[model samples]
Target: MRSIPSHHRLILAVLAGACLALASPAIGQEAEDGLEIGDAPAIMPVDPSDAGEIERGARPSSSTGDANRLDRGERDSAPPVTKGDKPMVGGEPDALQGINIYLRMGTPLPDVPPEKPYEGEPDTAYGAFQRGLFLTAVDRALPRAQLGDPAAQTLLAEIMSRGLGVKRDLKGAAFWYGQAAQGGDPAAMFKYALLLMEGKEVPQDREKADDYMRRAADAGNASAQFNWAQILVAGTPGVRGLTAAMPYYEKAAEQGIADAQYALAQVYSALKDVPAEKKARAREWMTRAARAGFDTAQLDMGLWLVNGYNGPRDYEAGYRWLSIAAARGNVVAQNRLAHLYINALGTAPDPIEAAKWYVLSRRAGLKDPGLEDFYLGLTEEQQKQAIDRANRFRRT
Candidate 1:
C-alpha cells in the first residue's frame, strides 16, 4: 500500500473541528405547558460561513491520532470552534437572523399537580400563546401577568418581541422578559440573554447578558448550556477551559445538542489524559453527531474509523463517512476521500476517483501538494474523466 502524506492529519483535524462546531444552542424543555416548542421558530438560520473563534485547547494533537494510521499521519482533534449570529452592537446585525426562536419556549402551566383531578378549565391562554394566538394569548395572559405570573409575563414578551398580534414593541418585550427572568423562568432567561446581546431592542448589556445566559443554563435551558459552554471555552482556551465547559456540554449533549456531542467526541478520543470513561463514550457521541447531519462529525468519524483511534479500523465505514462529508462540500473530507481511493483502503484503487475528489477540494481552496503531484501524473484521458466527475459533483 502506498503511504499517505503526514500533513493530511492537520488538514483533516481542522476540517472536522469546523464541522463539529455547527449547531444551535438548546432551548428550554420542548414540552412546557403541556406542548412541544421546538427550537423557538426558525427566524432563519445564520449563514454557516461565519466561523466563531478557535478554541485554545491545551490538548495536544490526537493520541497518535490521524486520519489514517496515526503512526504515519499523526492527526489530532482540531481546536473546537463555534458559529452564531453574533450581531455586535456596532456591526451589521442579522436582524432577521434567529430573532424569533426565543418565542418558541413554553413553560409548565402548573407547578404542582392538582391534589385530585379537580375539574378545572384547561389553561387555553398558555396554549394559545404557544400556538401563535397572540391576541387571545395577550388578552388571557395580561391578567395573570398583572398578577405576577412568570409564564404569563414571558408570553407577553414573546408576543411583543414579534408583534405577533400587536405592533412590534421590542422595548416592551424586554420589560416583560426582564420580569419573567427575574421571576426565575428559564425560557425568559434564555430569550432575555439573546436580546441583551443583540442590543437592538433594548440597551446592549453584555454583563447582564452573560449573567442571564448562565442563569438559563443553570435552569436547564439546553441552548443556554451550549452557549454558556462557548463562553467558558472562549474565556479560557485549552484543557482547563474544556474541562470546565464539560459539565455544560454534557448537559447540552444529553439534551440532543449535536455541537456538544461533537465537542465531547473530540475531547474524549483526540485529546490526551482524559478519563477512560470519557474516551469510552467518544465513538458513541461521534456517531450521534454524524447521524444528525453534522458534516464535520462525519469527517471525524471517517478518520477515527480508518485510523482506529478509539477502536479497530474499519476502512469501509471510514469510506462511507468520508463520502458523506465530501458530498456535503467538506473540503477536507474531499481530500481524505481521494486518499482513500488511492490507497484502496475500502474500495478498489481508482486513480480517476482519487483525482475527482482532489479536484473538488482544490476548487474549494484546499491546496494539497501531494494530491497535485498525483493529479499531474494522471493520463490526459483519466484527468478529463476526473474533471468531468468533479464538475458534476454538487453538495447534497
Candidate 2:
C-alpha cells in the first residue's frame, strides 16, 4: 500500500487534535491557565497534478510548484463559527459539525489501486507501462482508447495527468478520465470527481462531484470510502450524515487508513449519550488508532487507561503509551507522564525522574506552576540529577 504523504499526515494530526480539543473541557481550562494550546497546523495546498496521479496509482513527482495554483477558497473554507459558541467542549461535534472538521483538514485526494499483472498473459501495452516505457505504452494504448477501451482510456488519463511521456495536459486527462468514468471505471470516477470539485480544466460542479464520489465509494475504493464519509458527516440538505458515515469510516479504518482510524476513535469517544458498551467500543477504536501511530490517540488512550475511564485502570499500560507519546515530543504526554511518575501510579515515585519530564515539558512551552514549585523544592543533588537526566533526554 502507498504511504500517506507527510503534509497530509500533518493535516490529519491537526484535525484530530482540533476534534479532541472540542471534546475535552480540560483543553479549555488549560487555555485559560495560560498554557499554549499550540497553533493550528498550517494547510499546504497539494499540486493538482499530484491529485490526478494519486487517484490513478502513479508515483508522484517532486511538486512542479503548482500547489499555490489551487484556489484557497475552494479548499480552506471552514464551517461558520456562530456567536455564543464555546466550541462544543467535552462532546463530539455532530456529523454536520464534523464536516467543518473535514473542510478544515482539507482532503488529500485519493489513491489508486496498486498495479497488478494483467489477467493470464501480460498485455503488451500494460507491460510496457509497468516497465517505465511511458511513450511506448501510450503509443500502444492510444488506439485501444480510441476504440473505446475503458482501461486504455484510464491509462492514457494517468499518463497525461502526470506528464509521464507527454507534456502535462490536465484538460486532456480530465476528458479521458470522464470517458473511463462513463464506462463504469471506479478509479476514473474518482479522478473525474476531483477535477470536478477543483474546477481545474473542468467546470466546478460539487453536486456532480458528490454523486461521483458516492459511486466510487460504493464501488469499494478505500480513498473514496473515506472521502465520501467526510461529505456525509458534513451533512447535505436535511439529512444527518453521521448515521450514514459510520459504516464508511469503519470500512476505511479496517482497510488500514490511519486518518480514518483516528476519525473513528474521535466519533466513538464523542458520543456522550451512547451506552457504556458503546463507549467501550470507543476505547477499543482509540487503542487501534494509538497503535496505528496517531500521537493524539496515544495521549488520549494513556489518559483513559490511567483514569479507568471506559474500562478498568491499567496504570502500567498507560505509562507505556504515555512514555511513547512523550518521547515523540508531545508536551501534554510529557506532563502527564511526569504526574504518573511523581504519584507512583504505575511505578515507584521518583521525584528526580518526575522533575526531568517536568523540565522538558516546561521547555516545550507548557506551563505547570505546581510542577515547577515541586521541582524547585528538591535538594541540590536531586536537582542536579534531574537536570542531568533532562540533558541526556534532550540529546536523544
TM-scores vs. true structure, each candidate? 0.66, 0.60
Pairs that clash in candidate 2: none
Clashing residue pairs, backbone N/CA/C < 3 A, model 1 = 19-296, 25-223, 26-222, 26-223, 27-223, 56-238, 58-238, 62-76, 65-75, 66-75
- Candidate 1 global TM-score: 0.66
C-alpha lDDT score of every prediction, in listed order: 0.68, 0.67
Candidate 1 per-residue lDDT over residues 1-396, each given as its tens digit: 112122111022322232234322111111101111112211111222211111111222632433211121222233222233344444544344453343335432334455766597677678876654456666787778768889888888777777665666666677778778878899888887776666555566667777888889999988788777766666555666667777887898899977778777765654467788887998999999899887767987888898886878899999999899889887788899999999999889999999999999888777889999999999999999999999898788
Which has the greatest lDDT? Answer: 1
> How far in Å is the alpha carbon of 235 misplaced in model 2?
3.4
Candidate 1: where are CA atoms >4 Å away?
1-122, 130-134, 160-172, 270-273
What tens-digit string does per-residue lDDT give for candidate 2 at 160-223? 8888766777777877888787787888777777667656467777677778778887998777
